[model samples]
Target: MKSIGSKWMVVLFVAVGVFMLFNGRAQAAYPEKPITLMVPFEAGGGVDGFARALASRMEKDLGVPVVVSNEKGSGGRRGSIALFKSAPDGYTIGFPHIATLIYDDTLGETKSPVDYSKYAVILRVDTATFFMYVDKKQPFKSVKDMKSAGQALKFASTGIGTPSWLIPSAVGSAAGFRTSFVSGHKNLAEAALAVARGDVVGGTGSYTHFRGVIDDVRPLVYMSDKKSYHLPDVPTIADLGFGKLSTLGVPWVIVGPPGTPEDKLEKLRGVLRKIIQQDEFKKWGLENGYEPDIMPPDVFWKKMGELKEVYLGLKPQMQEKK
Candidate 1:
């Protein structure tokens, strides 16, 4: 019996060693297969466009197909949950709205499936200032008009967890107006379309998806510490005296599932760093409303932590009835 047990142990040890050796090589040769970049929104939405553009650039550098998969639902949490729960292999990376997810998971009354902090933070890819846009046909031309209208204006958002909901809700409360959010649009483009078609009074998002409908929907308020370069005449939320509702616009970050191999993560990060430094990539982001803000993994995660603290400070307001 002792001899048989010894033989079995030796075989087991050899098997384990072989597995580890192959795994290390797999990590070293990351992207041996096509990488799947899971974007948690509909295809035509802001996140999807950004992901596809990023994938194109990544493919050029990585020399492998970078396919974008849209996993739309729960205002982003659905696809995000899929991403975080996926295997920690380098091939299954994704773009998760870590900042908004932080707001949803921590201060929100209803919890989300994503743990916000569970994923591997690759880097902060882009940031855009939130803007409130309303259809031109709407009677209100400005925030002041909407405030004094004395009726609750209907608004739409991709999900309750997104800035489209939070910004409108907070801004309405602080500015002394009654407003209600229409949720379940899947993404900002749909919400913007709802605003254009008069399905809702307005919506808020960084990318308004106003290409052909620029004249149709007009921006009412910008939610940033400063005015946007394009909308220099518009007023920020702070400028309108809602300093308490201060918010850094939405951030889209690239991430991997929890426990992704360190070597694979580093390899991916190096490729991204090269892409981010490219002039063409930076130009593309600027033109697409994707403010190219680059940060290392540690710095980006630290900033996310700080953002969570800021959101926590706004918990009282977030819980208030809109």
Candidate 2:
């Protein structure tokens, strides 16, 4: 009953409506599908355990399964690459420590696919607090005793470029002592075990990773300038005259691949904020030696940039060793 012109207008309006409807459906709230959390460590490790626990809690909040995928290799480089290569749809995220993210590239170990800028850092859950520990039954109790031995102490290392290696190397260099690393352990737990079995003189890593084996090791010194809240009686590396070499603890950040939608990022951030707030999470963190210190995206990324500069300064020294 309408004129040809009016009919065409009606058809155009309907077409636009249909297009918009489909577009709306396409852009529907993020995480319509299950999200994947890529943990760059073995199943039994602390990072893996934390990822699984967080995924379980996130699933409750998201109403969608938050699956944990262990893509362990290259001292976490493999998992980080997998995370970098994943589509930027907010479906895949990575839980790699700050050190691993920059280590490979900084040391020229390998070319990483991740564009550090493209990574949308979601949260910084905690900082890695390392302690220098020796076997409880070892003959030497103090650094002076080890120094007086007049030989290079055999230290258990996770691998080259990890905190396990860097911390000890830095301390030994600063303290004017000699150390030789025996690399091959998968994680700090294994390294600590090696120390216990007399395979190595000492081991260094996060206190959380060493908690299970603390009974078998004597913590010689904390790596931070200040004493750890958990190990109040322990002396800091600074107090022992190696303060100049001590780097701030490495940050543990959760990051999404490039081009992740801002809204989606915020949604996940909110969920994580709530997750960290849960009493159960807080209790577990304390038990595991993880300090609950969550930071927003801006602050987290800013700190990451600052830490990168610190690593850059250390690169010349690292290269000299190579």
- Compose the digit string of candidate 2's lDDT tens values, residues 1-322: 4698899999999999999999887776567899999988888887877778788999998989998999988777778778877898989997865576676667657756676667878887767778888888888777656767578778898777877877766666666677778987887888888988878889987777778888898888887788887888888988998665455466777888878888788889899999998888989888877767788878877766665776677776666544
What is the lDDT of every predicted structure here? 0.78, 0.79
lDDT of 1 by residue, 82-161 (tens): 99999998889988766667887677777767677778878777766788888889888778788887688888876665
**Which residue runs does candidate 1 get wrong by more than 4 Å?**
1-27, 243-248
TM-score, cand. 2: 0.88
TM-scores of the candidates are 0.85, 0.88
User: Least lDDT summed over 10 consecutive residues: which range in candidate 2?
Assistant: 242-251
